[model samples]
Target chain A: MKLSELPFNTQAKIISVDKKIISRVAAMGVIPGTEVKIIRASPLGDPLELEIKNYNLSLRKQECKLIEVEKI
Target chain B: MSKNLALIGNPNVGKTAVFNELTGQTGHVANWPGVTVEKKTGKMDKEFDVIDLPGVYSLSPSAIDEMIARNFIVKDKPDLIVDILDATNLERNLYLAFLLKELEVPIIYVLNLMDVAKKRNIEVDVDKLAELLGAPVIPTVAIKGEGIDAVKTKIRKIFSDGKLAQKSSIPVKYSKEIEDKIQRTEELLKKDAPHFLSDKRRWAAIKLLEEDKEVIKEISASPNGIVVIENVKRFASGSEEFDLAGERYNIISEIIGQTYKRDKDMITTSDILDKIFLHKYFGIPIFFMIMWSMFEFTFRVSAPLGTLIELGLGALGDLITIAWPEDAWYTSLVLDGIIGGFGAVIGFVPLIFTMFLVLSFLEDSGYLSRAAFNMDRLMYKLGLHGRSFVSLILGFGCNIPAVMSCRAIESEEDRLTTILVNQNISCGARLPVYVLLGGFILGDGATGTIIFSLYFLGIVIAILMALFFKKVIFKGETAPFILELGDYRMPTVKYTGIHMWERGREFIKKAGLIIFTVVVLMWVLQSIGVDPDTGLLAWGTDPENSLLAGIGHLFQPLFAPLRWSWIAAVGIVFGFLAKEVVVAAFGLILAGEEEPEGLGKLVVGNLAVAGVAAAAMPALVYGYLVFVLLYTPCVAHLGAVYKETGSKKWTLVSATYGIAIGYILALIINLIGGVYF
Candidate 1:
């Protein structure tokens, strides 16, 4: 499923990221093998905060949709 | 031998904190450098020159900060690269450290935030990590000055030895295929560009494989460069960039597995706090509440201090009046021109410092990022990304820094739009005008509400203009928001004090330089009068016949819709010099009229004489307040916008847009109020 569709607080592994932002996403430590947890969605539920590599990152829902993740 | 050391790290890794601790110089060490977009250089014990570059996640330049960090390392080639790694998040931070390793400089790995890591039960085997990375790793709690001496001693040793000392000569190896590709590229570079191969051929090779445009451009300019690039591209499979990053992560994960240990089940303090702070419904309200309290705290705590400075300046002016001989040119110059004009601007210093202190606290505490996170949806609706909200909040303190801080926004269109709309946000300089007008119309009881409404109005107008610009002028796709939410930490007193003092010093400098000269020129213009009978220039005569009045009369019609008199017109025109000068202008013009009274009384009396009825006072005052709120920012801010955007067209657009919007808003307010009141 798209990473944005993952329920809050659920753990997932990033499978692949959209090519346009793949390098940026990978540089930020979100690669195919990294385990990520949706820590929290923003108040409006559009931007989702994810915990990856023991650090927190907030990404917009549209951008999050670009990342294909497998629910673990 | 070079003595330069560059501090490189990911965002929120306490890189600047370590720089400050080592150099004893505060270089805006906040949770993020994206907000403070400037490199700082300082001396380390008079031997090593420490340069703090902006934080970056990788060597690749996506944002301006990354571009700067990468450019400095490649171009400047500092002797020692102090790669700061957050001990708690070593796995991610080591990604950048690996990139720095490619730069082929002598690197000292500083594992900062050791205290926080320990508190969270995260431990690192310093020796093991050092062995793997082939550098010396020093664990530090920079805010408390731990491990700083070790860093300094290492630097001293490097200087004494005249060569870099390493624990090991290990190199990070990628997969066989990637390694083969890199070796081929390196061989080609060495053959075709032997001059450039001495220092960082490995880095250039890797970048070529990753297809870094800048690196490709540099290499393609050399002999056989195009042939080498074409050869490299043909050999690379799917995506070499992703492969390099994944391989780096593999190396980092292996090292971290051996050296790092953490209590995986324990929830961090940041996560616990984020539960309440980032709550879907409560987050935004909590953000507003914090902001409201900060504003209240700023005004309440600084009000007495502001009055104290005013009274002190007033007494100093009184002394000057008594000491100087009456009717001498120096008398007016010293008392009115120097003390009256500059003192008015300087009097706001205490308040400005208080606001800066609160802002610094927010920034250092890491709440500013959360505020941006909460406001992301709303900011998105306005066609600006979430990060622009940080610059907007900064606009309340000062617009010059706000405009400059737009560098943090990754997209060019969004940054420029933020800069253009930032001027509408009521800055600290405009607070005095609001206070005076609000107090005149609604008295002290409603001053808070009035001022709050004006600030709110400025924000609304700013957002509307941003949307309009996004749709019409600078049409483009808005960059997707991706922000790092850092850990919440208590702000160090020294850091906060230095930040507050830096801003206060800047404001004082402006008062002494720009405001001081502008006020003197204003005094001269007001002093020169034209005699009606012969049209001969007369000095220190009736202000009604002065050059300033004639100039005021020319612009008076523009403000006629808002019912502003000639003096008010003059005040608003000179306000372009500095917003604080608006109040000083009124004082100067009124002092020339008759016996000077309290500013509040003068404003009320002037409006009464202008035939402004009590019923229409609120609307007129509100309209004037909105005008001041939306008008063109001070000259310093305009200069900042020009410098930041590097386009005269954008600067002119910003100024003209502000004036047009302010006039239209005021006219609408007047027309609507005339019918109701």
Candidate 2:
């Protein structure tokens, strides 16, 4: 499932990140094989703030759609 | 004898943890040089003084943090420079190591984060790498204190040798044509500039080849500048190396291919994320929502704390009045000037703290760089270099740091432009203005809308200013920014909390210094008079009657054109001293009213007056806000301008230009509104 489609605060393991999101992911140090734990999602479940590798990052729903992930 | 050493690397390479392992004492962390980047210095287990410079990618200073690191290395010239290379990202880390080596300083390489590398199934042979570079390379897990003692013992032995080991030439690989150009430029440079980092000079030439503005300016300003520019330009233009960024990337790619082995898959992570976030249709809204929430949190989460701070100041003022019942001057000084003025400033502490906390989270978690990347196109549209986006973001914290952050832009023109536009960023200090005015002029719920509008105003004004400055002041080609978007990391809560509190404590400390002095000065000005018996002091209740009031009156005609009442006019005048003081003065004037409840009541009532279905109120308020927004930034910000620009002329230009633009805009708003209303 797309990461953005998940309910708020849902934990997910990123399965595949699309090629186009490289710059954004690179900026955030998010590489394809990293586990992402969602901490909070904006009311709409679009800009999700996630906990990863000892840090928290917020990404928009549309942005999250690029990442292929599965709920844990 | 153990010699002094400093570990310098870009932030996040475990410099602090390494310092802790080496020193055994929790290192004392402060800002590097004058910049806000954190600096850690301590004794190496009671053997040597080890300074941990803020994490910086390269020695060519750009940001406050980078400048601090660069200046310390250049000015302090530590005995040995330990360049900590992140094992996972050796190529980029080595870019800085290459620069350090060029400084003619002996740099020992420590490949940190080996555990993380191992987890990733990446392997690096430390001995082979050391042999290749002619520097001892030690692999260690900085977090676990692994191999740190060995690294320190090697440093001691190297110091005992009394002569540093020479590293073989690690000439960064560029294209063959570019390499030829560098060799030519090196020959020309060798004749005159012996003291410079010859390799750094080569890099600077290439940056200039890429038409880097800041480097160009530095060269142009020097006596040898014209010659260097002509020589480099000849080589740059001849080879069509204007695509310097692409060329540099290619070189890095080639070098990585040869020396480093990575799971070729790592690059794909960032690309995938960038696609959606950098997508034209969706990226902007996502960015806007993030900003909206940031402001929302800044206001909402802080409301309770704001009340607490306000009440604390109120109680303190009440205590002073009760304690000094006999001393009216001192009582007024404490209550009206000190408490009142200071309270107006301190009231925004909650928002400041929360904002910093969020900002630190964004920065440490690596979202800020993404935001910067997403904003790059817009920044270009606004006629600003993308690097300025980072500084502008920093401006949300404080104009001083923001102004200082401008150094990150490699172009002098961009740096100056960023500094000028920085004031329009509306720092936390000025948040009180938005909170006060938005609350006072708009209404309770509308306060958010008002603050949002004011922020929008700042952005619009910044865009306009950029356009104007580009056309008039610093006219040249708009330098295209090529930014490296770092990967995302889960932000460390402990680090983010520390960063947030550190900034909050700074705001409190600034109140203790800058606001304290100004508050006392306000009291002194209020107290002085010619005669007590006549009750007609130097300046009457009318602003024209007193010293500051008299000066304010001199500018009344200028503001009169804006439709401000004399008291309102005077408030804007005192705003130059500090924007927050505008509220304090406004509070004092309304307190002069019959049954006035001071600032709080004045804000609530006046905002209602403005919100009522009256065209005149909106017009007048809009005009008033324009003046407030464009006028000279506070004295502290001006001091910051002076420090950042390092010129009295530019500071004057910034102050005068802001006031001039503000006056004209305010005049237009009021005049048009007057006719329509």
Candidate 3:
């Protein structure tokens, strides 16, 4: 499911990363089992502020869809 | 000679903190060897020398910084190479390590931020990994002084071993067909060129197949050039060859998997902290507030010190005026020209240092990476790299280091874009101009508002300038920015203070060296005149008489369109030479009481007396400030542009474009206002 489709403040677990997200999501140390949290979403649902581990990482709308997530 | 060991790594990887721990002396910040790659090198415990090169990803050798790091490792050949790696992101870092191993130098990997790694439940056996690569690996938390001694001892052992070239036997994983193709390419390269290329030909061939420009450039320059490249590219399909190139990653991933296992963790400290900083409602406002506070603190907190320095310089000028009363020419030279020029600049040390202090704190705490992520959208629209904001922020302190920070940019076009527009950001030297103009227009109470507006104008101009330059000189789509948003960590006060002091010292040194000489020259020009009795008449006294007066009158027509008096014209021209020179020129030529106490009042009085309306002062002041903020950079910054871009054409283009835009903008303001007022 698209990350923007998730409800705000919902915690999600990343299941698999596809090749489309290689540029943005790949360098960020995002892999299977990495816990992700949606802290805030922009009004347009483009850049979503996320909490991954100890840091807040922002990903563009297109980059967010590459990570297939399972609701915890 | 103490054997120097430069600790090279990407920025925010705890390099400086590690340098401080190793050296035990305050580290000094300066340009890297040959270029303005902001480097920090110090004597380590009085025996070993540790130089910190600016952060870079690959030694592909496209930019000045990459060249500097590549040259240093290849030429200077430090006794031992300590490649510090962020443990959290080993994949990307290990890519560089593989390249470093090929340098044939003894390299010891320092896995920093191991504490952060432990939090993620990712575990690695350092010894096993070290054995696999034939290099020593030591886990360290540089901020906490952990494992430094062990790293240091290992470094000594590396020196003793005389840098025994460790032939890396770690094979890359490629398909059988690709491996056979690479073997053929390697044999051909070995036969064609044995001593010309440093890296293995197989690797070079692979890179060529991947369309790496740097590798292609080397091959084209070689004996069998075009044919060899055509053969390599023709052998492997583009996508297949590219996968083969990434074979290094496949091998590394399997190796890491063998030594490490990953698990799920509930929460990371970075996540908990981001809850507040990245809050949707509060994020943008909080960022603005923090920025506002930084500017406020820089000026207000440093005001007392700035005032004290101004007074001290004034007193010194007075003493010099009194000391050589008979040598009027020499005395005026010392008092009006030299001291006046430097005094005007020295007063800004506090603001300069404070800006550096704030940036250092943000950078050391790893908050700057987050800032890049936040400002990316705004910067992208401006035709610049997102990391350019970091350079622009650094420009607040000084333009020299700011230009150097352009190394973080990966694309040539974006790098040039950042360098060209960087000076639009108000530098410390321009602070006095801001303070004086802001005070003149808005009074002391509104000084903060005026100053803030000038700074904002700088940002706006930078964005516009980037758009203009890209459309004209550089025409291309900027390579999309891909950056790792590092987690925020608590900044170490010790390093922050030390870093701030280092920047402060550079400003003070520049003031002493450049300002002192300019002041002396100004004094000599005015003092040694035919009629020694009356002293040099301040410019515009007789219009036809006095060197400065004649020059100011000649330039008067040009500035008339900007609604400036001959005196203000002189001030603006001097400003182009050096922004602080504007204040000194006004103080010397226009503020006529031999020595004026309040510079802002002096400036106001001169303009008011010259038929420049009191109300027009604000418009004129804002207009003039805008011109300076967006105008041609001083000689030092231009020199930096030349060094960073390594092109005289770009340097000339940047300077000419800035001045043309500044002059046109200043003229537009006056033309509209003259008809109205």
Among these predictions, the greatest lDDT belongs to: 1
Q: What share of the true interface contacts does candidate 2 keep?
A: 0.00
Q: Tell me which of candidates 1 and 3 scores higher on lDDT.
A: 1
Lowest lDDT 10-mer window, candidate 3 chain B?
Answer: B536-545
Tens digit per residue, CA lDDT, model 1, B1-677? 43888888888888767888888873433322333466588788776788888877876666777877888778887878888989888888888888877776778888899999999888789998888898889888888889999988887886787667432224567889989998998998888778664577888898888888788888778788898888777777758888888889998899999999999888988888898899988998899899999999999998898889889988987787788788898888777676666666666778878988998888888999999999899888888988899999998889988888888888889988998899988888899888767876577799999999999999888988899988888887888787888899888898778777777777787877777777888889888989887789999877789898888888888777677887778778988888888877776666534435466567656642266667776777788778888888798888888888888999998889888888888878777777234
lDDT (C-alpha, whole model) for all candidates: 0.82, 0.66, 0.69
TM-score of each: 0.95, 0.71, 0.83
Rank all candidate structures by their TM-score, best first, as comma-separated numbers.
Answer: 1, 3, 2
Steric clash pairs (candidate 3): A54-B269, A54-B270, A54-B271, A55-B270, B333-B523, B337-B519, B338-B519, B338-B520
Pick by DockQ: 1 or 3, better one: 1
Ranking by lDDT: 1, 3, 2
Q: Is candidate 1 or candidate 2 better by lDDT?
A: 1
Worst 10 residues of 2 chain B by lDDT: B604-613
iRMSD value for model 2: 10.6
* Model 1 misplaced stretches (Cα beyond 4 Å): B26-37, B165-170, B196-198, B321-323, B531-534, B592-597, B607-609, B675-677
